[model samples]
Target: MLSSLLTKFLLLSCVNHCALAALNGHCPPLGPVLPAPTQPSKHGAVSAAATTLKGIINKTTAAYNSSAVAIGVKSIHESGFVFSYTYTPPDKDEIGTQAVDLDTVFRIGSVSKLFAPLALLKLGISLDEPITKYVPELRALKSQAREDSPVWAVEWDDVTLGSLASHMSGIPSDLITDMAPLGNLSAYGYPAANSSELLSCSGFFGTPSCNRTAFFANFGKRPPAQVPFSAQTVYSNVAFAILSFAVETIAKQPFADYVGKEIWKRTNMARTFATQPNASLAFIPVDDIWWPADLGFEGPGGGYFSTINDLHRLGDAILKHKLLSPVRTRKWMKPVTSTSSTGVLIGQPWEILRAENVTSDGRMIELYTKRGEIISYYSTFALIPDYDLVITILVAGPGTPGEVTGASMDLMMSQVVKTLLPAVEKAGKTEAKAAYAGIYVDQRTNSTITLFLDDKDDDDNDGPGFSISRYVIRGVDVPTTDPGGTTLPASAPPALDPPMRYRLYPASATTMTRTSGSGLEQGLQQRQQISWRAVGTRSRGADEVAARDAQFAWPMYSCVTWATMDRVTFGFGARDHFVFNLEDGGRAMAVEAVGYKVRMERMSPS
Candidate 1:
């Protein structure tokens, strides 16, 4: 069960060369890795979420062998604050705890899986490409978990790069020691050894580190763990190891070196080292005692040490599409699996968990998390995208009962979400969404769009002032024929008709659910519908207010197209979003959409 929790936690993040990549079509070769930047002093601003964490830990530590704990929380979206706290035991030697803040680095364990995919994606490698293209030696691994299976060996090409990243590679969850039944997987599962032995070339791998020659020699002689091309997700550390190996082989450098060049250096994550630089900071955990420690070698599965601020910077970069293109970022977050028994959907190097338990109102919680735990440390890095929030927690302690490594990250998450749910938020809301409507346009693309209130004036509607809004991308000539189908005639451009209009029903005061004709072009009878949640809301305090400014106005933000893969589902690729900056009374000034800003001038009422 603890293993299940561990499998549920690993997640992903960003890289450097982000701006360069956005400008150019490819990620350039990275230069020397630089040090992390100095963070401004702002420790007192820990959000209410931190308060919940402190309360929980303060109460829960009563059951622990030692009361020392370290916590980190950053709420950058709405409230720009970074908070980190470290607790040292009265008898410091007993817990072996260090006085470290959010910037203090610790072993991230499986959270390192998140970085692997980012590194791989930075190389512009297709997730659908077969692993054999990078590591052909994998062909040596066959379909047999044991040596005596009579079936012919399946080619390694059957496994794609995405499968390995998402744990759908069909590789055995772990290496088999003594020919046991798959049902006994819990007993002899992956990384079957402790952290020390996980990446030990002399132990499980039976090959020299980064040496394909040694690896293939050992791999060819053994039976495969599972059949290739199988859809069943079997979380495999070996698969990640192979991915690491392939990335290194392709880059002609070590995995850590490549990541440092591509990610940390680029993002100014100065202290986020590939290895634990200060040995004194690491602790060895047993039942109730934590001594000075050593984890293991850097690998694709888990081998990173990062501070709270650095991790937050990484998440922010990914969210803003600064590290990767919005399209790739969306694809990276898209579900790689259908619903599994655990109600989990695997994404690249991470898992989007659909919690089985429901809130009081039957609201299902979908948690996007990357969790990690080893002998001495446990961490949970999560993105609650719906709330525009990211939570990162790292704690080290004794092997307490029930929770793994004496950490209640899941409970901590649940408590935070429940306390800050929309209901709680609305109870405190003072502003209305009436001031968020206006006509906006993207001048850079010559794309004109309008967001007008649908005054179908229905007094029968429940609450005070919720109204439907229509978003129309006018002058759009959404292509009729599929790109792969019959070619459009040279004169087809002029034949386009009416603009695509979408009706947005109120989901909340500021948010709207898109109900639209599938694709812009209605050529096919089976029109695949598109889904969008639009929010035109704003908040002030970059402090641009003047005494004459009667309205406390801010930029209206919304991401109309959160997913790019939906284009494949909906036939044509035309999704646009905008952040409209308004005049005194929510009248439009200018708006930034997609790549550039568009000036919006209000038209006099006709």
Candidate 2:
């Protein structure tokens, strides 16, 4: 009973010889499949995953400035359950108006980044292989430490495909800014294309033959980018572009042809493509304004037009190990944790969400997610391997991209998962009490943050299995760097906001999320809301997880990290996560909010 959209639907019933069948087989009656709610419900029931999702869409439609969005759900056990819900944009159609549903396609930006790695993996190319082994131009280019810094030379043969995929290679963040001017830039460039304030590229949007050979040639031609190669996890759009070039160079075929045969065709993504096959593409509104730009030039990374059905097909294929081996696919989803202790990690293009006991499977479930934003569209996908569950959200804003306060995508996904598949708690584990409470201060800005576990309110829901405890935050600090090398904290001496309380729900023996709370007050990424997952330890840093029942007398899971936050706008899709540094071994030595680019030392354990 999928909303009105499930009429004559198709699901991959079996996977034999990497082939699929469409059948209406028996699926367990787990949750309610309801129609789109007129309003988004904040407190969602267990049987209302779809209803809750629709509610969220309805509430945030105006807040996020989105014109239209399509959501797809695919679950596999004995049978496959695939269904989708699409919201029609209010105004008229620019290209094909009726209302783009699961069939309508969109250029999923960095989400396309995964295809490059998958193709390489399918081609039997090892992740550890040097990228220069394929593309000779990369080997010939000089290496720079920074775009404006003195040009330094290095052996380009050292950079590997895995590093580039994981965003660990210190490639240029922007090619048009770091490299020479383009010879044949596309004329259909939108203001978002040329504006780094919005996106990374300053040249073309889609695939318009913007000269890949010449682009790679100019890499070492000038000074290097800010971060050097093999440095930390610094995001580089050019690195992905280089990966595309490498894949094409190694296969001895154009990237478009290679992916067409290798990935898309195998997944049965008929209406999908790596390039803009149609010129009269739909009007992709940014904010409320329609944005029109092609993602072709950066095809390997950003330019991919796919439909909801195709995305579900792709997810199903991955679950069935359609292209790569299970071992390879598992490795690709593993976390590449950063050294900052902020819990950030990247394996291939997927952002690893590490949590403890997030499902009933006894084993720790890791949710792999990827988010993409080009000129006109913003897309995201969350996949739970243990549950074989996948949720993909494609959004087109109907208003200004920065000004509006959209729904919290992370929270929405987390809530949907919680409602649909309630996590089994670690036996003997009680509500998380005092380990995280402390007065933490940022060293650079000399500003502080104080955490308090508050008393239960009289009017609060006290009849639950485990009573919810309020986690309060008092002081907030923000730092910014000047044009010079000196760093400056915002001059407004930070005052404590009326204590912001986020209800903490215990996931396992040691993990808690802001899933039950209202999240943060202000001054973080998007600052709209901050949904957090905290994993505490008595040791210095996060320890490796063996298995669920193996008995973690010590550390629980690996990490629950966050992506970097935006300084100017706090869109709040991803988190600006904080990590506790334990030096005394029992309590934290310091707390590092890595995504916000600040570190706070613990004064004393409360």
Candidate 3:
């Protein structure tokens, strides 16, 4: 009997368009809907995949001629799913190359931008507040500007902490060019070192020679990239520097000290520091021209060094919402402004990328990501909220030609996300099947339905939802019953015919009270109510579908399923909705087909 049931499931598509009318005649309740969790599993398969992926990474890192690379992957929902890979160049050097590992620290460069906003968020500082309120030096700079200065002069009073963090402050990208290579001034057309047209903080070595006093003294004279509050996302290292100063002033502690106590310490990122750590523990690339130099005021912008293990901890902390309240974290993760590209968005310090075709159903996934580079080092990390996944890549060596380091980072990101997202989706489906795939029956009404997740390798077998393997209503096989557009009453009968297909997608889940029984039985019985959207397919052949599509010039004509997906409504609620009463561990005890006005209890385990 079990083998026969399995064979029936294998042969079926789902419920067809004809069966939908029988199931969706009434209305379903309108309750809150939430995103389904991507239940990541702690399975050996992922680890084995990672092991294979690491080999590809090793070849790519070596091909880029990187001195060393460290990468880490963590699953937020699943314990024992941490993965790390390290690669060191085969060539030896006179400076003595130390073998790098997960614990060996590397300069994370501009990735430090992440900490400034996090610290301010922790302090309960209003992001909309003008930055000048805390960084009075900015106010001084605005006041000192000439009355006849260009219209692009930054309006410090109008710039807010939010704007700075989101790279919309319209400030200059750099305050000093000390990092720029020194060259003959006369050959480039005439600026002597003493000329006021040139910044006094010139020359390499002692060049960033500009202290806080000299930095602010000469900063006012520099022209702004755009007027304050302009709809421009200018990548400004100086903006983060100014934001750090504001943070320090408000927290009444140095920026580094504040973050150390509030962020790094709390997140257990022990190896992550605002300044370069001890050389013995760090992988300082051998580069005389752009060696590890103190960023001075810009330390908060791009000076932190961290190990792979610390980054994993930080990512885990952010995903688990251990660093901020759930509400605030959600707010923080969203885009502050949209960019010119449809697939790109700008958040506080995030470069949000909208990835497509990562799943079998072609759903878009938004990745909250950050990239950093400083001379010889490169770093990037992407946090995928949909999959509860985090991936970090750090590279250090002499800068490679053709920007190979960047290409290597992109390769790692695209490949890992492509591989892991589907794995995570499959894992979530596996978990869902165990919890929800079963027979539900209303014995009194003689209605029964069998639901199961399609684990078939062929994507064309069904839609990206739970398949209705078997469905019957009032002793009538609904899938096989062809009403031929005739509205049959709940108690009416229709002869069984050819079968059709249907699938159910999750809509919402909420806790509600059962007001049925009395006393203890009705004591505010809390059960999770989950609504599913039932969708049915037309039994059309591929040749007919192709002919119909060829006639319509518009592409949406071929994709009108979404038009009636959740829009249809009846007297009580949404049509084709099923509300499942869930127990702990997300197990469904019973289900109610609201549109059908029928409640069914879960059948006993097979």
Candidate 4:
């Protein structure tokens, strides 16, 4: 039943924009059109943007003296815009100056956690099910309350697979603890470090005792940071380690093999590995101590090594819904819990970020991202679904600290987002012009409307929606006419003195199937039903209008714009609601004014 539900959702696309309109104040009254998945389009602007990005990567990596940095960017809208850049520092040590490419492997650190949830989901494992269902040994565990310590023994029965995946299981951050690292606890009335408190066998700390038995023994001694299902997001590497045990128990095979077969193989990520492959095949940084450390049980948590090409393939597969259904993919990408920062949230394993002001319109873009650092290897993978953009950055070198790597990645990401959005928007406008921006006329009634794309890029200067230069009903200019024969109604925008404007926004989109067509077009032809809102507005000049109306021009300019905008009504429908009659390739053949009950055929551009 669950599988069928997922399948149904996968086949369906978001049909109505009204839900988004109701939920987001930033959204227009009609809401934006539901965008379909697009392959890369041919756009020169994207190429220029890629060049700018390439320069930024080269200059920044050189400045940091990065031993090796591999970056790959793919834009869904532009096929030729795929960019890849790899840098390897000059010859040093026995290995000498080895070249790096998209396929050159590097340890991905905590980024490996991203695959664990995917594997569990593929196995049809109910994420909400208690961890004890798969790993029965956890059923015997109970919490121990301590007055002085923040840690308490985890009631594993209370922890679900989802909680473990999302870092909300309240599991302790790690299983291993060093007695000497505790320092003097006598001041807090706690016992001083003793032999009993010594850090024991566990793979998390690179100890040799790396089997499941040793892991469970060490875990029982450690305590959870909080109760299960806590609202707080307390990251626990051990959570994934525990998840690996559940996976192995259910599959009756090692966790690595399962992920390799199900995810990597399916996604075409041939260069990714469950563990650090031989050093000869990987681009290991010189004198890296963490490179040689065996992860053992922690391998599921932070032990995978992947290449830029592999990460790119993974990102594409996710966005394209190659493995999971579209519904499941979207749900998995969403935030599971909020963090302290309003801009940040935590998903199953994603560090989701709300990036504001990346676009010229000042709208926020959510970035589904993950960051990893193990030893001197740093990596970041992000998916910006709004723009259908994927970014992968991998760094291997001596100076790969969290701060340094973070800043570098931030620079790359910021540049990409800022540059690509405008490029994509411009490309979209160009495409829109060819398809919808033209003169539409009702020759029987001599009515006409001319639509054009706004040239101004600044939202503050002029609101950026599809602009209308002319509108006439029955040869009567509605914008300039008084409330008699030419006027729409009182509910619509009042007749303006001069400079009247109308901006069209997408309201809804639907799909229709042919029931009674014949000949070559007889076999179930599908057409897209699209509704656009004509937001008619009356104006003098901005200064003149503000001077005339004291009440409308407020200290808070258009704060209640949603209340007034797109509310124009006729008898039963919106006065300015227009529906496009699209052909096979989404070209507008004609537009119907819903309230007016009049259809206008599109006229070819002169």
Candidate 5:
């Protein structure tokens, strides 16, 4: 009897998305779709717990979206526990609290990209594989380009799967050029009709006038020998769609069905779908025909949908090597390009971010995470190898700021892991850190900074090991002392207190002389000395001493020195110095500094 109910539910799900056939009202064949397993009697308890957690997330989302039309949350565990919560405004006349089941499907937007890369990997396609192997028409397009034709002059044959996946292919961000023409194109629909229509009409890529197919075909017809690639990362939605088409061609199956069978079904994901037939299933209602109709089936980028519970199952499958082998999974999680260079890698459409997790015990764990957002939906999943925990969240509605959502979710999961891992480790469990350690450049300044903890010793005298130290800023080491007056370890100074030392050595400041002496043979060398002064100030709670040290010895080295009674904060360039405020128990709350024209803002605790 339970199996019958499970089968009925799965049938309903497939009916919700499968295209209707001509003569019969019956649902399409469940070729790739997998039915949800019958729920064991024990699942009731897990469902109850999930429902409670979903309530918390819904309330939080409601509080964040005070002005938004509606909000909801769906949470799931890999064990098949599912929960969902919905909130409607009291004063506004929107839809009421209709609980959208976790199994209900919605357009996952960019999250669909995760499957694209997986499909490529599953087919044993390397990142370096030439795209033309799957899309032979590109050759014809490349051959037609003329030296004078601006669009046709470039050769795209050399572009590989890796380049497209990483957004290094130099594809235009948009295809439409004129707003007037776009008005007509707007009525076309999604996975937009043809390459020409997409290139000439779609907004996903920056080009406004060229269709994706035409763009590729033109490249084949008149290939330019060389085209300069962008130095910075360019996020292209069309590129992923094209890649998806390639996947379909290579797999010789409908892209969505192929993914469902090879990836989702293989991993036992019963609730995931690429598209939904029922518009009401959406947490936030959307026009199913928003984009060109022909493009609707494109699955190279964002398009898959699944509940939070199913996502957790997917995450578990990924970590457990149930989907791709461990080696392939590692490659997917690895940083393909510096974050600064490319806002983030174009992984299957999922944006990958590398983060550092600092444990309370002073150990730093590195994490690689993927986040997806589409219209009114947001999803984030992170696998922390060091703690052996997979955290996933899916939110529905237009509420919290995207940045805040990601940061808050990450913080919450990090805290949960921090609390749970110690006990797990005590039980003789081993944890592994993620392998995404490296230096990343900040987009603004392009300054590269390390991001992982370095512990390897390079006795061979070569460059330091890439994995040695996780990201740590030098010149600010905090010493941890153990009992018996021994130092436990050194780490980056906490931002809790103001800096204690401030030194400003003028460009002209120089050391005077150097003297080396043993008992018998001593040598003294005269050195040039630049005039300097040392100032020390101590905070006396309300009052402090401002003293100048004139008799301080000057060394041949160039330096400036200043001391404060409390702690002194240093600002770059021409900034003033200030002190930190103490909290209730005389503990410092934050570091404060004042400059001549700049005021220090308190940084939030990470």
Candidate 6:
């Protein structure tokens, strides 16, 4: 049986369009969904994989300043189950293990929409089914006596299940503020309660605070008919809740139980659930109690839990069309609404879009992905179809400090994708070389230094073939030269003693030799041989020359010249000297000076 299961899984692992077409009416043979992958009997390998993945999560969390993080991934062909990893920062202890069982229950938040759309699809409910047919309360709410109600109250009479699934129902992102005060009565009150009080006071007939009864009474009192439809992308939890209620009315079963029996169980998602963890199961206590206790039990918008193994199974099942028929599954994944050039379409809770492309060796590859985040927990599930790879990451506890946001997760996922995916596509595409060719002018010296491709007949040919030419203010005919000439006296030798002269010659790609002299070849050789170590010298050498010229006129001093075959520009002034270093390997080599600190800038190819 195990061999047969593995064979079926291996056949289903390929995710091409052809594979999807092949699975048009196919479902995995009906049986109990396989259990979560058993723990490896060899503890060493399991611990090593866990430890490595944990370290990765910890590093990513720290980089994002997140308090905790969890991640899981599965290879459909090789692993056949999800491997999970998690991390929690030092400051938080919210009563839960970082490692959650695949079967463990937690609020899936908006992920619950995944099941709602599936349920509607299974009932042969067209995406265009008018919401009013299932939930007549919306019509009753439209007939409120309150003048504040829109003179022409808008309802979901024309909106379809499709629109709600894709967030185009024109409903507000949240009705919580409008519904909060009504508490249990809100849904039943006036049947059209737009305020908190109505929701709190109304309930089903014959029960204390029976909002459902009041809601139905009010609903029956009002006439029902289709209303005008206005379509726009609007995220609304209320819409999904209403839809879940509609599914229950039609299917004659609780929303959670219906979804579990028909969808999750049939798909063999044994670890999946549509409810909160009961006393029998271990639950990590959440520190913040802001969430309503009832909300956790309601499974439409935000309630479910599963181990990494189950998630991978879910990914595989979706890819293989084991639950919904291929035609319906494709519809669920398709973008129902057109997005503007700048806008993105929301397919169910997943954002439907193309993956980012990396330019390498002039080739492109696509990676389809979906990411999730809620309160303190963050999650990501990426599917690289061509590579047959699925990556999922979940995080718990506080994310980066200040405003709780998904920007940290976005940054981390971007980096991970950039680093991991492209390597599989192509290899050995060298990065472009750094462009270091330029003339840098020192504003203080009014001198220009030209950094040129070095062509000197030096034995160190392995180094970058670049050198710097020190030009006096008068010698070079260049634009954008510094206006102030060198601080050296006008009497200095024009050839080598003019304002500044420093030549840096590359002894090798990594080592540099510099020579400085005043117009004499012998002096050049002597200076070149001098071991000029990087040091801190206070005197500018101008002081010594000035002391020798006791007549009190300006001192005549020789300029310093250095040359490098490596791409670098050298500049020296009374107060400071700078070396602009560059290498051909697209890496930044350091710029060194005698008294000042060195700085480097990594250059990118244009």
**Candidate 6 segments whose C-alpha is farther than 4 A from its true place:** 1-56, 63-66, 80-84, 90-95, 98-105, 145-152, 179-231, 279-286, 290-292, 296-298, 338-343, 359-373, 381-388, 399-405, 424-606
Which whole-number lDDT from 0 to 100 does residue 598 have in model 5? Answer: 24
lDDT of 6 by residue, 354-467 (tens): 442332211123334455545654456666444345666544544436422577666655655554434422211111112333454444434454444323453221121223
> Taking the tens digit of each residue's C-alpha lDDT, what string does model 2 give over 1-606?
222232222112111111101101111111111111111222133225556556765675554333666777666332333335677656534554346677777667678887888878888889788887887666556642234233454355667888788877666565554222333345545222333222234444332344565465445644444343444567777677778887777788988898888888988888777655562444344332213344434667776777777787788788667878877776777776453533345778888665433433222346788877764567777776644567787766543553221345445556555545442121111111234455777555655665543324433222111221322223332211111111443665444332212222222112222222335733232211222332221111111122221232333222221121222222342122445544322244665554445567767565
Listed per model in order, the count of residue pairs whose N, CA or C atoms clash below 3 Å is 7, 26, 7, 2, 75, 42
Best by TM-score: 3
What is the TM-score of each predicted model, taking all chains together?
0.59, 0.55, 0.77, 0.76, 0.49, 0.51
lDDT of 3 by residue, 1-606 (tens): 235454345224232212212222111111111233444545455556666777777667656444677887777765544567788765423353378788887788888999999889998888899998998667677554555254636778889999999888887788666422455567767555544546656323566544567668767766687766667667788788888888889899898999999989998889887765667776665543444477777777887888777887888898778998877887899898887777789999899988645665444478899888777777887787765678888877776573346666667778777766666666666667777788999999999888776646533332355777777767767676633332443455455433556667667323454555678878565667777777665544332333333344432134345555654444666546788888867788888877567888888532
Q: In candidate 1, which residue pairs get closer than 3 Å at backbone N, Cα or C atoms, i.e. clash?
A: 9-370, 9-371, 10-370, 10-371, 11-370, 35-270, 36-270
**lDDT values for all models:** 0.48, 0.51, 0.68, 0.68, 0.42, 0.44
When summed lDDT is taken over every stretch of 10 residues in candidate 5, the lowest stretch is: 541-550
Regions of model 4 farther than 4 Å from truth: 1-41, 77-81, 91-97, 143-151, 176-192, 202-206, 249-252, 400-404, 440-451, 456-581, 584-586, 591-600, 604-606
C-alpha lDDT of candidate 6 relative to the true structure: 0.44
**What lDDT tens digits, residue by residue, belong to model 5 across residues 1-606?**
235555455344443122111101111111101111122113444344444555555555455432222212111223532323334323221332234444544445556667776788889898788777787665455344554353554345766777677766665442222233334444654233444433343333333324455455433332332342455566655566667778889899877878889888887778777654444444442221222122343434554566655666777777667777777776776655554622244343345543212322222244445666554455666665543345555544433353224455445444434443333332211101121123332233222223122223422111111122211122222111111111332463245232222111111112234445655546543223222111221121110110111112321111122222213223442222323333332222332223212222223211
lDDT of 1 at 212: 44
lDDT of 5 at 118: 76
lDDT of 6 at 294: 37
* Local distance difference test, candidate 3: 0.68
| Alpha-carbon deviation at 444 in model 6, angstroms | 80
Candidate 2 off by > 4 Å = 1-47, 62-66, 78-83, 143-154, 177-209, 221-231, 279-283, 286-292, 339-343, 355-364, 398-411, 423-606
Query: Rank order by TM-score, top first?
Result: 3, 4, 1, 2, 6, 5
